[model samples]
Target: MTIKEKADEILYKTGLYEELKTYGEPHPIGSYRMDMMVYNDLDIDILNNSMTLEKLHTLTNYILKTFRPTWYEAREEVNDEGKTVWFHGFHAILMDELWNFDLWFFDRETITKAEAYCDTITTRCHQNPTLKTTITTIKKDLLTKGLYHYDKYTSMDVYHAVLTENITTTQAFLKTHPLTTY
Candidate 1:
């Protein structure tokens, strides 16, 4: 199955969205939103400040027991926007493939700006249809060369390169910005 198909299976069929609704709204972001998915990575943005520390744990517990992911982790960190977030990320072998899920929890105040930024990227990718192809190519090449590390960069960086700047090739991307681990 394609990534979209598997995504739907995991999102709706697994009742992931319904479970998430107990805490807040679940909004898929990044490449998933832009239809530029190059790998088995899913990004979710949860807003409304409804997911408190306690609720976050309860939800994660449910995920752990139900999904039985190979591994999972949680963190509290400040985003690039300087807004603190509760991040619950996990990796699992699902549908005979390894999938990464990034669940970002944010308050209403923080989500407003975050959603707008993601929407802008989605809009830009939609406008320039070719950008999606270029993005997937760049991402696929990076992955093939073992140069694309999730910890080092994000889809936002990729979108920024293709949308704001004219950086295209993986070589150009590497030279233009230091896509390295912190």
Candidate 2:
């Protein structure tokens, strides 16, 4: 199946999208939001300020009961904005492939600013196909070479490398943007 179809299957068919809506507004980010799919992942940020233990428990419970995730983790922390945030991350075997999801739970105000920033990036890429192509190539090349790591780099890094730094190749990205930069 295609990338969008796979996302639809996991989000819509599996009812995760609707379930997330009950708590907050869930939306895509990074490559998924920009339609620059080069990896088996989805990045969703859910906006909710009043996140209660019961709400979290119910959502996670639903996920655990409804889906068979190969890996699952939940954590609460203070974000860079000094706002309390929660993260629900998981990887599941879907369509015979490992699919990763980053479910960031944050207050609506905090997430709105982030979403707006992502929107700017998305719009910029959409308006310039050549820029978008350059971006996806760098991302795909790095992933294919096993250069991307969860603890190291991300698609956002690639975008930053290209859009801001004008670095287009995999080598340049690795050389210019170090692990610490991410």
Q: Compare the candidates by TM-score and give the number of the best one.
A: 2
Error of 2 at 158 (Å): 0.9
For residues 28-105, write the lDDT of model 1, one tens digit per residue: 876677667888888888885544677767878998987889989987777797877888888888888899998888
Best by lDDT: 2
Off by over 4 Å in 2: 178-182
lDDT of 1 at 57: 77
Q: Give the root-mean-square deviation of each candidate in angstroms.
A: 2.5, 2.2
Q: Given candidate 1, what's the lDDT at residue 127?
A: 83
Model 2 C-alpha RMSD vs. true structure (Å) is 2.2
Query: Which ten residues in a row are the worst by lDDT in model 1?
Result: 48-57
TM-score of each: 0.86, 0.90
Model 1 deviation from the true structure expressed as Cα RMSD, one decimal place: 2.5
Pairs of residues at least 3 apart in sequence or in different chains that clash in candidate 1: none
